[model samples]
Target: MASSNTTLAEASNITTMAGRSNSTEAASPYSFHFGMLLNPDYLLVEAQVIFSALSIIWLGAHASLRRPPSAAHAKPKNGKKKVKDVQFAEGFTASDAIMLPVTAAIVLVGLYYALEWFKDPDIVNRVLRIYLSTVSIASLGAAAGHGLDIITSLVFPGLWVDRKGTLYRVDSDHQHQVKVGEGDVETEVVEIKTPFPSFLSTLPLSHGKIQAAWEIRNLLTEEWTVRLAAHGLGLAEFSIKLNTLLGFLIAISTTIAYNTTKWFFLPNLLGSAACYSSFSLMSPTSFSIGSAILVGLFFYDIIMVFYTPYMITVAKKIDAPIKLVFNTGRGVSMLGLGDIVVPGMLMAMALRFDLHQFYHKQMKLEPIDLVSELATATPGETVMVSETQYRRVKPTYADPEGQWGNRFWTTKLGSLSPVSIATSVRAATAFPKPYFYASMLGYFAGMLVTLTMLLVFNHGQPALLYLVPGVTGSLWLTALARGELKDMYGYTEDGSMDVEDVIVEVDSTGKTIEAVKSTAEEKGETKDNKTGKEAVARTEKGEGDYDVFLFSVTAPRRRAPKRD
Candidate 1:
C-alpha cells in the first residue's frame, strides 16, 4: 500500500515538473489542466454534500442508538413507540419527534455557517460576535445530541438508569445527635422542621445530584423556584459563566477550521491518520483513527446545529466539577480542531494552486479535459470501450483483437479482476480480532487498488480516475462508522437493563417527589405578642415530613466498550 508520504513525495515532484512544463512551452494536447484542482467551489460543494450525508447518518444513529424503551406497562397504543407520549424520569420528558432531527439540523447549519464566516472572520472589533456565533453553533450541536439522549431516557423509562428510590434526609442532618438508648443512636429533635428532600433523585450519567437539580429546573419550570430555594442551593451564577467559556472554545476552533479550508477531505484523512498514530505510531489502529474521524465527521456535520444547545444543556447538567466531567466524556483530550488545521491548510493550498494535476502529471496521468468525460459514458461509448477500445488501450502487444490482450478483455466483466477476490479472501482469513478488523483490511485493500489505478493512469492516460475512490470511500466509511456506534450503544425494546441496576431509597427526606410534585394548601391562626413564647415553641416543634417512593434503575456495571 502507498503511504501518504509516498503519495505526497510523488505529488511534490509532479508539481515541480508541471510548473516547468507549463511555463517553458505551449500547452500539449496531453498536458493536464491545473485549474480544476484550484476550484474553491468544488471544496464548498464537497463540504455541503458530506455534511448533508452526516446529518442523515446522525439521525440514523439517534434512531439506532437511543432506541425507545419497551412499553411493557405503557403499551404502544397507536401501534408505535409513541415517543412524544412517554415520560420516564423526573427531569426527562417526551420531546417532539421533530425536535430530535431539528436539533441535528441546527447543528448542521451551525457547521455550515461556521465554515463560511469564521474561516476568515478577522479578530478585530466584532471578534466577540464571531466567537459567540461559532461557540453557539458548536454548543447547540453538543447540547442537542445530549439532550436527545436525556429525552430518550426520559420517554423510554426502560432505558439505562441506575439509582432509583434513593432517599436523602435534610432535616435528619440538623436533628440533634443525642444518645437515646443503650447501644443505639438517636437525634434530639430540637427544631422539628420538615426535612428537605434528598439532593439526588434520578441517576444522571455524571454529577447525578447537581444535574438532578438543573434538570428539575429546566424541565419542570413550575417547580423551579421552590426547588432552587430548597437545600443544596449554592453558586448558580458562576456556573453559567463557566459554561460560556466552554462554548467559546468549541466555537473558536470550529470557526478556524471552516475559514482555513474549503474542503474537509484532507482534514478528515490526516486527522484520522494522526488519531490512529497515537495508539501505535508504527502500527495504526483502525478503530482509533476511524472513531476519531467518524466522530469528528458526525460532530462536524452537526457542529453548527446542535453543538451550542447541547453545550448549554451539558454545562447545566454538569453541575459537578466542570474540569473533571468535561475531561472525562466529551472534553477528553480527543482529537479536536487542531488536528484538522494542518491538513485543512494543505488542502487549501492544494486547491488554491491546483496541485492535484501536478501530482497526476508526476505520476504520468492526464487531466479530465471535456464535459463529455464528466458525464456517464453513453451506451454506444460503453460498448465501444468494452469491445474495440480495450484493444487500442491495451498496455502493449495487441495484434488485432485475437491476442493475449484481446483474451483479457473478451469476457465481459466488472472493473474488479480475479486479484480482488484473492485479496479479499486473504484479508478475511488474516484477521482474528473481529469483523471490523477484517473491514479495515478490506478498506486498506480498496485504497491500495485505487491508489494503484491513480499511479497507472497518471503514468499512462492521466484522465481523472480519482472520481471512483473519493465518492465511494467517503460515503461508505461514514455509514459504517454510524452503524458501529449504533450497534454498540443501541437499546432494545425488550424491557431489560443490559447493565446493572443501582437501588436507591426514596423516603420522606428524599427530593424525588418534591422535585416533580406540586404543593398543597395549609391554614393557621395567629395571635398577639402575649402568645409569642407559645408561638415560638409551636413553630420550633414542627414535625419532619417524609414520604417514600421506590423504583429500580439500571447503571453501567462496568466501563462500557468504546471501540472494537
Candidate 2:
C-alpha cells in the first residue's frame, strides 16, 4: 500500500506557523529530531503494516483452504447440514488485468478534475463514501464472520462441525411423493421425510439453542441469487445468515461510532475488512493473470505517485475507509487500499497455486468411478438399471476438524512434538508453500524498503513500484528454481478440478425427486434415495456416465402407418 509523507510536510508547516506566531522560545533541532524518532505514530505505522500482512496471509490461506459448495456439503445427518462458503461469480481474467490500469487511470484523472472544478474534496468524498460505505458494510460483515470461524476452529478444535453445520428448518406439513424405482418394474411411492430438530439444544450451555437461532446461512454464503418479477414487484433481495448478520451489525456500529467520534481505528478496521473481503470475492485465478495485473499497476502507481499529485491529493482529501490513516500526533500516515489489494491478490494466487501443486503432486489422489444399481418391478417383469459416476475426493487439508489447532501444548519437556507451535503454524504450514513464502518474504522486504525510502527521501513513494517487483520476481524466481514454470503457467482456477458427477433421480412424472451422491461417499455404503430404493454404490476404476434419470410408466407406441 502507498505510504504518503504529505502529512509530514503539513505538520512541519503547522509547526513553522506556530513558531512564527509565538516568536519566543526556539525549540532545539536535536529535540525536534528526537521527538520525530520517538513518535508514537511510528508504532502505529508498524502495527498497520503487520495487520495488512496478516490480513493478506489469511486471505490467501482462505482461498487455498475453501472448497467448492458441492464438495463442502455433507449429507443431512440428524438435522445438521454443512454451511457453504461464499465465492465470486467469476474469476479475474487476463482482460481484466489488461484493463485494470487503464480503468484506474481514468478514475484518478476524473476524480482529480472533479476536485479542481468543485474546489472542494468533501463533495467527491461524500458521494464516494455513500457507495463505498454501503459495500464496506457487507464486506466487513462477511470478513468478520469468516474470521470468527477461523478463531473458533483454532481455539476449540473439533468442538464444532467442520462445515459449521446448523440445524435445518423443519416443515412438518409439506410433503411430496417420492418414486422408488425405474418404471420398467414395480414402483413404490414414499413420502419425503422431514428432518428432526437439531440436538444442539442438548449441547452444554444451550449451544444448540444458539445454533437454532439461524437458518439457511449457507444460501447467500455460497453465491448470490438474483430474482426478478414483472407482475407487481420491482425489487432485489440479498440475504445474510446469522453470522453474517452479526458481522453486519458490528460494521454498522463501527460506522456509527466513527461518524460520531472520528475514531481513527474504526476506519482502519473497516479498511482492513474491505481488503480481506476483496481478496475473498475476486482473485487473479492464476500466476500469469496476477503478474500481468501487478506489472500494469506497477507502472500506474509510479506514474500517479511520482509524476502526478492526484494519488496523494485524493488519498489525503478523502475522508473514507478507502485508506488506512494513523494519527502520528503531528498529522497522519496513510496507506491506500490499492497498495494492499493489487499485490495481495497476486500473493493469494501464489498460495492457491501452492495448494494446487500440493494436491496433485503430494496427495496424488486419483479419480474413481462410482457405480450405482437401481431396480424397478412392473406387472410380471423386473428391470435392472446401472449407472456410473465419479466424484472428486475432499482433501484432508480442506477438513476443518483439528485443522487449525495449535499443537505446541502437546509438547512435553522430555519430548518434542512434530507440530510444536504456539500459533496455528501447523495448519498454516501444513502444505509446502515455497512460492507463497517467497512472495511473503518479498512483500515484507518491499514494505521495509518503502518505509525506509519514505524516511530517507522525505517524500511519498508509490508502494506498487516496490511491492509488484518484489512479489512477482520472488514468485518467478521460486518457480524457476523449483522447475515448475510449466506447471505455474498451466495452472488455472477454472473449477475443472473441482467438478464432480451429480446423479439426479426423477419420478415417472418427470419431476426431480432427489439428488443422490453429488459428492464422495464412503465405499460400499448403500445410499437410500427418496424413492425408497437403496443403491449400492462403490468406487472403481473405469469410465462413468452421470446424468438425470427419469422413469415413465407408459410404453413407447408402435410406429404409425406411413405418414402420407
Candidate 3:
C-alpha cells in the first residue's frame, strides 16, 4: 500500500519536475480531473471510502446488537404467525424501464455541457451562462431524482419520500404553568403533532435545507413571478420598472461573486450531494432492483472511465463541487460520492433485513402475511399485515451455456399501503442486523485494492469494476453459506401494507353474504387514536435518532481545513 502511494507520488513529482507547456497533455494512464483536486497526490478519497465502509459495518453491528422492539405488539394476523418473507415485483413497468436510459442520457448531456461551457474561453459573459446552465442542469437533476422515486414506486408503491404517506395528527398540547409576574401564572402550551407510520413510508431518508446560492435562485424566481403578474394585470409600467431594477441588481451581484470567488463549487456541491443522498438512501424493494442498479452503474462507470476520456476530462476541467474534495498542500484526491453511496445503500438494506430476522427469532413471533387494515393501534403495538405473496423458482436467464440454467428466487406483489415515516424508524430498531457489514468491509477492502492498483498501473480504472463484485459477490457467498439465500432474496425494502377484502363466504351449498367487520369499531377509534398518539409521542422522544440508518451509515468523516 505504501509503495503504491509512493509510486503515485514519484510519478506526480516526475511530471512536475519535467514542467513543460505540454505537461498535462503528456498523457498517461490517468487524466487530470477538474473540481477542487488537481492531481491524485493525496490519499484523502481512499481514506473517505474506507471510513464510509467501516461506518456501514458498525451500523449493521449496532442494529444486530442494540436495536429490537422493546415490545413486539403481540397482535397476530387472523390469530396466525407473521410471514417475514418479502414479496417483490417481477420486473419494472414499461415507463420505468424506458426512463432508465433517459436518465443516463440526461446525466451525460449535463456533464458534457456543464464542463464544455465552463471551460470555453470564446464564450461571451461566461459567468452569466454558467448561472443559467447551473439552473437548467439542477432542475433536470431534480426531475431525475423525482423519476428515481417514481421507479421506486413502480416496484414498491409507498417508498417515495417527495409524496406525503405519513399521517401526523395533533392532539391537545402539553401546557406548562409558570409564574410570570408576582401574581400571574403564564401557561405555555407546547404544540404537538403525532405521526402514525404505516409500514410503507418508514424506509427512505429525507432532509430539508437551502444553501448560499439558493438565496439567489429564490430571488430570481420571485422576480420573474412578480413581473409576470404585473404585466398580466395590465400594470405594464410597473412591470417594466420592477423587472429592469431587479435584473440590474441580480446581474451586478452575480458578476461580482463569479469574478471574485470560485463560483463553480455551489452547483458542483449541490448536484453531487443531491445525487448521492437520493440514490444512497433509496433502498431497493427487490434483489432485482439492486442488481439492476449495480449492473447498470458498473457498466456505466467502466464505459465512461476507460472506454472514453470524457468523464475524466470533464471532472478535471470543471473544478466544480460535483465531488467530495479534500486538498493536501501538494495536491488533492477526490472520490465521487456515488462510489460509496449506491452500493452502500444496498448494503444498508441487507443489514436491516438481518435485524428483522433477529427480532422474529428472538421474540418467537410467527411469520404472517402483511395483511393490512391500518386502524390506529396502541404505541409499541406491531400491526400485522397479511398480504398475498406469490413466489416462483426461475432461471437467472435463458442461456445455452449452462446445462439448464442458474435458478433464482423471485415474487409478485399487489398495491402498497400508505405508511408513516416513523414506522421505518421503528422497523430499524425492531429487526436484527449483518454483511451489509461484510459488504461494507468488502467496500473498504475493494477501495484499498483499487487505490493500490491505481498506484501500480498509474492509470485510472472504473471503481465499480472492482466494487460491484467485491460487495455483491461477498454478500452472495456469505448468504449462500449461511443458508440465508432465501432471506436475502426475500428481503425487499418495501413499506408495503395490505388490507384483505373479505365480505363473502361460501359453503358447498350456496353463497352466504357476510357483512365486513370494522377494525376501527372493534378497537374503539377514540381510544385507538389516543393510544396511537401517546405511543407516537413516546417513540418520537425515545427513538431519539432514526438517522442511524440514513446517509450517516456511510457518511464521510469531516476533513480538517487544507494546509497552507
**What overall lDDT goes with each candidate model?**
0.26, 0.54, 0.41
RMSD (CA, Å), each prediction:
29.8, 16.4, 21.0
Please provide TM-scores, in order, for all candidate models, with all chains considered together: 0.20, 0.61, 0.43
Candidate 3: RMSD over Cα atoms?
Answer: 21.0
lDDT of 2 by residue, 253-287 (tens): 77667666766588778777877777766768778
How do the residues 143-251 of candidate 1 rate in per-residue lDDT, one tens digit apiece? 3333343442233211011124111112222321121222212323222122112122333434454434333323321111111122233212111222233434543
lDDT of model 2 at position 400: 33
Off by over 4 Å in 1: 1-64, 68-249, 256-445, 459-564
Candidate 2 regions exceeding 4 Å error are 1-44, 56-64, 68-86, 151-156, 159-241, 362-397, 400-429, 499-564
Worst 10 residues of 3 by lDDT: 402-411
Best by lDDT: 2
For model 2, the run of ten residues with the poorest summed lDDT: 12-21
